[model samples]
Structures are given as structure tokens and as C-alpha cells.
Target: MGGDPISLNQDADLHLYMDGEMEPARRAAFEAQLASNPALAAKLDEYRHQQDMLRLGLDMMAAVSVKETETLAGRLRWRLDMDRFSRRVAPLAAAMLLVMGGWSLTVWVQSGAGTGPQLAGEVDDVPAFADEAAEAHSKAIALNTLQPSPPQVEAAPVPMQTAQVPLPEGHVMTVTLPAIGPELTLIRASIVPWNHGTALQFLYREPDGELLTLFVASGGPAQDGTLHTVVQDSLRLVYWRAGLVAYTVTGNKADGDLLTVAKKMADSIRRS
Candidate 1:
């Protein structure tokens, strides 16, 4: 009786007499309100220690339910008799391997003239093809580059120009070219300055005015006598080559309107 005691219908008749499903006059009025309540007799001893730990975990799952139903009926009778035990052991394992290969060829023809049975030295375990044939003969002697020099000196830097400004109408831009060729329609004056053979810096403007960049190089204008170039500082740079990929488009916009928008986007991709 903690001062003004029970009465939400006597705490739903003490939870239906602690759930033994009530009725003996509502379990004698919930054992006379748990003998006049010391906090309802500590909530009926914590609901009888949670109904005796749920009947000792359902009597340990009813003692392993008959040894898990006889190990699931012996794995469903060994998957319904595996094809009559592989048709009774495949012809007695091929007549015991043809009677042990005819008694090992009649004891190697009665131990012949130059004797037999001297084998014990097998250490191969399979891994030394001479270190993979000496790593494929040191990768064929480092790809055979036998002394022949002086033909690869490309380092001519001094080209920078790019500009393409014109997207203001509805302003939406996202260009990622260099997957080389065909999908080209990037207007707003075709922009450029993506210098190959180096001296780079492409574009920038994202103080939330959104415009950022990148245009790198390592040989373009398909090499021989190389000539694909464009540069613009303040923003703009475009360089081009289409098949084996080479493209550049920087931004900050000025070198003579980014080299006249990189020569009208390289003459509109060499006239389509």
C-alpha cells in the first residue's frame, strides 16, 4: 500500500494474476493485492523470476527434441539411398583395378636380368622450372634493347593559349573529355590551351561560381613533328588528338580569348 494504492482496475487485476491466466476469483484478488503491497510484493517477485526463466528455457528445448528427431531421420535415409550406394560400388572398383595390374606384371617378369625395386629418391614436388626459366630468361633479356639510341628526345615546352567563354544563357557545364573521339559538341566558343609536351595550368573559378579544371599531356599531335597546342592564362587551354586520347581544356579565360576558343575547337573537330 504505497499511499493511494492500486486501481487501474487494480492494475488489470495484477496482470491477470501474473499471467497464470487468472480466475480463481482472479487468483484470490491477486493474492490479496500481494499481501497488501510492498510495491505489490516486489512486483510479484519479478513475475516469479520471469516465469522461472521461461520454464527453464522450455525444459532445454524438450531435451533436444528426441535427439533432433533422430538426426533428421538419418539425413533423410541417406538421401533416399544414394543411387543404391553407387550401384553397389562401381563393379567392385573395376575388378580391384584389374587384379592389381595382373599382379604387377607377374612381379616384373620374375625380377628380370638387370634387377628391379630400387626406387626411393623422389624429391620433386613440382616448383622449380629453373625459377620460371630464370624469369623467362630475365624477361627476354629486358625486352632485348641492344644498344640503339638517340630517337626519343621530345621536350619543347612554350605553348599556352586557351579560351571558350559563352555558356551564360542557361549556364550548365560539365566537360570531361579525353576518352578520345566522337562525343564532341562542347560549345561556348570551343575553348583551349591544353599544351602538350608541357608548360601547363588549365582553369579555375569555384568560389562557388563553379568552374574548375585539369588538362595534362605526354605527347600529342600524334608525335612525328608534333603540333597540337593551345594555351590561355587567366583561364583557357585546349589541346587535341582523338583516337589514342589526348585532350586538354583549362580555364581562367584570357590569352586572346583563349586562343580564339582554341581555334574554334580545332576547326570543329577537323570538320567532323
Candidate 2:
């Protein structure tokens, strides 16, 4: 073995020799030089050891990178599935909330807490034409168009003030004359224009000279035989339905008194 190191060009060839890229003749010559030059041989051993360490480090990094990529892909897939599930469920949850809210609102309205009209019976609401009836009464009174009744007339079907205005065809309603107490005199009876159909308006005079109006229409709901009352324009109005005929009695009287008169009138029409 020589004590001196190899030349620079021969040292550069060491890697080619170690990697077996050198020609066979050159590889044999380099091996003989390594056997004789101890320093060159030691240097080749060090380069080989460094290459092995670098290869081991690169393998470890590649394994860690692959594992991390798999974990990241799994988390992304889980998140996508959760997002899809939420999208499918969102509309159903919104619909349930809307239905529940509507139900609660209906309950509040029916419980008499809302601003809608209150009823004394199991009926849903006041007659739809109640406000119209009240307005007609006021207009008639303001115009002083009501006639005075003949003194001491009994409760009977009064003569029509104008030509008979019949309900529109296809309406199943029976126009029955209301038989109220003798204390209420029929002052005027006429057919008036109504929204759903023609309506019968009857003007009556109470014992105290207070005027009362009874409006009859064909647009009532199914007869629940319940009396409902509401106040409009400072007038107490009592209303009910019998079969297809609906009746509203309005007067500047106490609620109980007006309701009593309405019930009697409704009963008379039902019997007729």
C-alpha cells in the first residue's frame, strides 16, 4: 500500500468505480490502485457510507410524505360527506320550523290573544259581511231613509220597500222572514246589494226609539247553531247562521240584550 494520496483525476473516478459505471479494464485498474493506496481506499469507503445514509434519509422522508397525504385525503373526504348530509337536511329542517311557527300563530289567534275578532262560541270568526252590515246601518241612519212603522203592528213579514232583489242563480238559500218580539216594530224592509249576493235589510224601531237593523245574506257557513257577536262602529252586532242563511243584527244596545234578540230571531228563521 502507498502512503501518498491518489491524483485529482483518479479521485474523481472513484465514484464511477464504486457505481460500476467504469469500463472493465478501468475498473480493474482502479481496484488495483485502491489496494495499493490506503488513503484513496479510505476516502472511497467514506463516500459510500455517506451515500447509504442519504438514501436511508430519503426513504424515510418519502414514507412520511405518503402517510401524511393519505391522512389529508381521508379528512377531506369526511368533510365533504358531512357537507352533503347537511345540504340534504337543511330544507327539511326549515320546513319543519315554518309549519311549527304557523301552527303556533293559529293557536294564538284562536285563543283570543291576537287582534282578530273574538267569538263567544266555537265558531272560527265573525261573519265576513259584519263590517258591511254595520256600515250600511250607519249610512241609512245618516241619510234618514228609514220609514216609521204603523203604530202597534205585530211581528210579521213586512212589505218590501222596493222591487224584490233575488239572490244570484245557483245559490241554495231560503229567504225566511224573521219573527222578532212585538216591542221591535218593522220600519223598513228592502233588498240591498251585498258582496256575495243580494241581502235583505230590515229596519226596526225599539221601544226607546233606538234604531236596529237586521241584515240577511246567503253566504253563511254551515249552520253551527252558535251565536257570535262583535262590536263595530260603536254598535253591538250579533250574528248567526241557519243552513245557508246568515243573519246579523246591529243596534246601539247592550251586548247581552242584542244577543238575546239575535237568538230569538235566528230561532224563528230556523223554525220557518
Candidate 3:
């Protein structure tokens, strides 16, 4: 205030003076100087005004920055929500497509398109025949091994060959006989009749040009031996019980010949 502009140190003291903390003598000296320096008085007024404006501008800038931060946070939240929504729908959309594809495949299969029925029919037919054959073979074994009891007869030597026998329902089964020789061919056969359970038949041929037939019924063995003796015309028949099974050998040849074949076959089976 006295010469050029007051030093910063002196200006600081002036602020303290304005707050009324200055000593009485110093205050009186500052007042005398201020009266002589009009330019310093104007500068002090301007400094006060600038400080007030700076504080107001800082308050406005702080409020604006907070508003912008809030707006940015809201936009980020909205984007996150949209992303979550899309993620949740993605699996649902994929599942819908898979379900649609499966339904189409099922429809195509059930409609019998693309050889489905023909393939199924062929598959079913093969198993049916196999089941029937298996069933027949099982029935024959059951008839021979279970039910009526039989006494095993002794073995005898004889010639052998293969033969086929006709049955009901157009079913024909082959048989091997002489019940002897390793080359003999036997076609296992079975028949089921009402009230009779099952009957197993084994057809065989002797080297002497004689045809032989073997029959086994599922029931107790005969006590009277009537079935063994009863035969039509010149056909010779012999029957015996082996374990729980009944065996009967019939042939147009001699009874000794039929018995010989039956014994050989039974021996072979037992050995096997």
C-alpha cells in the first residue's frame, strides 16, 4: 500500500486485519495506509469477489460431475440387464430348436417313410421264425427229458443213414438213424398235440434200406408195455424209459435192428 503492490506476506496480514484480529496500533497504521492507497483497496475488493466466484464455480462443477456419474452408472446397469436377458433366452431358444428337430424325426419315423416299415417288418419276421424254431427244439427236449419216466435200454450195433419225416401243418423234419456211425445226420424235430403235451420224433434210416422212427411222449412210462407191442402192419417198434424220459424206436425192419439203432443213439447221447 505504501509503494508498489503490497508483498504477499503483507496481504496475508491484511486478511487477518479484516477479520479484526490485528493489534490496535497496527490496525490504526493499516487504516492510514489504506486511506492513501485507493488502488490497493480496489485490489482487495476484487480478490474477495474472485474468491467467492471460485467457490460458486467449484460447487456447480461438483454437482455436474455427480449427475454425469449417475447417468453413466444407469446406462451401464441397463446394458448389463440387456446382456443378462439375452443370456437367459439363449438356452431356451436352443432347447426349442432341439425339441422341434426331435419331433420332426419322430413324425418321419411313424409315417413309415424311407423304408422304416419294411425294415421293421423284416427284422420282426426273422425273430419270429427263430423263436418258433427255438420253441420247437425246447419242447422236444422237454418231452424227451421230463414228464413220463423211462428205463434206459442197452446199446446194439447197426448201420445208419439220414431221413426226413412228414408232420402235421406241412412241417417236415429230417432224422438220422441206425443211430450208428459218426456220419449219421439227425434233424431234431418236435410236435405238440392237444391233450398230449409234446412228442419228439427222430427219423433215421438203416443201411439195410429200412426206415426207422423214434417217438418220445411227455408222460409217465407205460406199465403194461402195450405201446411197445402195438404197431401197424410190418413196422417194428420198441420203447424204453431213460431217466425221466421215454424213448420209442419204430421201424419197418426187424425189432432187433430198431433196438440196435436206438441203443447206439442213446449211448452216443449219454457219452456226449
Candidate 4:
């Protein structure tokens, strides 16, 4: 009776929604309320802005790795009370800005600010996965080289054209091995297990005798078809996601067209 009952109830519901704790039916109901209540919708937008700022500030500070930032951001999202989010984030974000230096911070925030959630954190999602893919490619190649080549027979041929790899939870992904050019041959397709999940690795031999591996996994943080590239040492990784699956093309740094190959793979997956 003392406060607006609708605002008080919805403020808590909004927090649950943002924290990803709301039940599906309840979430649907809350979203329907957003359609009818302009004030509630505005409040939702304000909270989202604050959430994005907190994530971006933590990312820009240079003290947190992407994985650690995601964990801390999750806790921050849960604890950001409706009335106190701005107060709690303002001082920390300001200090992060100072630590990052003014000109660079200004450019980064300007580029990503108010562009919705994907652009807010997409830049911070690629490095860890890219490193893993590169490592997997290296290890797979080393193992393959240690094996003895099977005898070639006139009547028998090995099947390297396509492979169906099994995944967790009874899932399966079809990998169409590509022979891109005369010297680029699809060598092997296999499963590599890691922290996130099992990835289907399609290994190929390049024209320069270098190995290229395309890693496909079922899920990734950014699935909006944005290509992210990272280079470490001698390897370059071009990553993108379409629908429910993600793709990464890993090759030598000298191979300047890996991004083009990744884009073509993404287009093929989307079309299929």
C-alpha cells in the first residue's frame, strides 16, 4: 500500500530475468508486461545498459582474462540491485577508464556502447577458444605424422571425403571434407575433447605443405555470425558462428586468406 505494487514486484522480476533465473513461462509473462508498460520497458533498458558497462569496464581493465571476466560478470549481474546498479558501477567504471588511459578507452566504449549485448562483449570472447583450436591443430598433426602410412591398394581406397563425427548427448555433426585445390587435401577428421566440449577437427594439408585445421563445436559465446580473428605465434584463427554451431579456421599466420575460408564455411553451414 505504501509503494506502487506493480513497480516493486516487476523490479525483482526484472532482476531474475537478467540473471537468467526466471522460469520460461514467467519470463514470457514479464516480456508481455514490457510490451504494455513503457516505464517498465525503460527500466529494463537502463539495467541492461548498466550491466553492459560493468562487463565492458572489467574487460578493459587488463587485469581480468576473458574467462575470469565472464565468471565475475555473472556474479555482478546477479548482485546488481535495481536501485543500486548505477551507484555500484560508476566509481569502478571510472577507475577502469583511468587505468585504461583516456583516448583508448574513449574509442573502445564509443565503438561498443549502446549497440546491444552482442557488440558489448563479442570482442572479448575469441582469444581462449582460438588458442585452444591452435593447440589442437598442432597436437593432431604431430600424432598424424607419427603414424605409418597404410599401404595403397589398387582395389581399395581410404574414405577421406566426408566424415560423421559423434558428439555428446547423442548429437552428430556431418563434416564434408574439402579438397580445395590440387595440393590442399582433406587429410583426416576426428574428435578432440576439451574443457568446453568435443570439437570435430577437420585437418587438411595446404599447398605449402602446412597443416590447416577447422574446428567445429556445437556452442560458442557469440553466435551472431560475426567473424573474430586472433593471431598467436605462427598460427592464425578465424572464428564465426551460425545457428547453434560455431566454426574456427586455424592455419599458419602466413596464410592470409583464412578469414575468407572461414566466411565461406559459415555461409555453407547457414545454407545447409
Candidate achieving the largest TM-score:
2
* lDDT string, candidate 2, 129-175, tens digits: 77778987887665443333446555664432222346678544456
lDDT of each: 0.40, 0.70, 0.49, 0.64
Q: Assess candidate 3 and give its lDDT.
A: 0.49
Q: Which residue segments of model 1 deviate by more than 4 Å?
A: 1-4, 8-10, 13-37, 48-50, 68-70, 73-272
Question: In candidate 3, which residue ranges exceed 4 Å CA deviation?
Answer: 1-180, 192-194, 221-233, 269-272
Clashing pairs in 4: none
Better of 1 and 4 by TM-score: 4
Stretches of candidate 2 exceeding 4 Å from the true structure: 1-125, 145-165, 169-173
User: Would you estimate the TM-scores of all the predictions?
Assistant: 0.16, 0.47, 0.29, 0.44
Tens-place lDDT per residue, model 3, 68-116, is: 4576578669867976997899689768868777556444433434321
Greater lDDT among 1 and 2 belongs to 2
- Predictions ranked by TM-score, top down? 2, 4, 3, 1
The better-scoring model by TM-score among 2 and 4 is 2
What digit string (tens of lDDT, one per residue) describes model 1 on residues 116-191?
1121121223122212222332222222223232243233331233323223354333322322222222111213
For residue 170, model 3's alpha carbon misses the true position, in angstroms, by 24
RMSD of each: 30.8, 33.7, 42.7, 19.7
Error of 4 at 64 (Å): 39
Q: Distance (Å) between predicted and true CA of 73, model 3?
A: 99
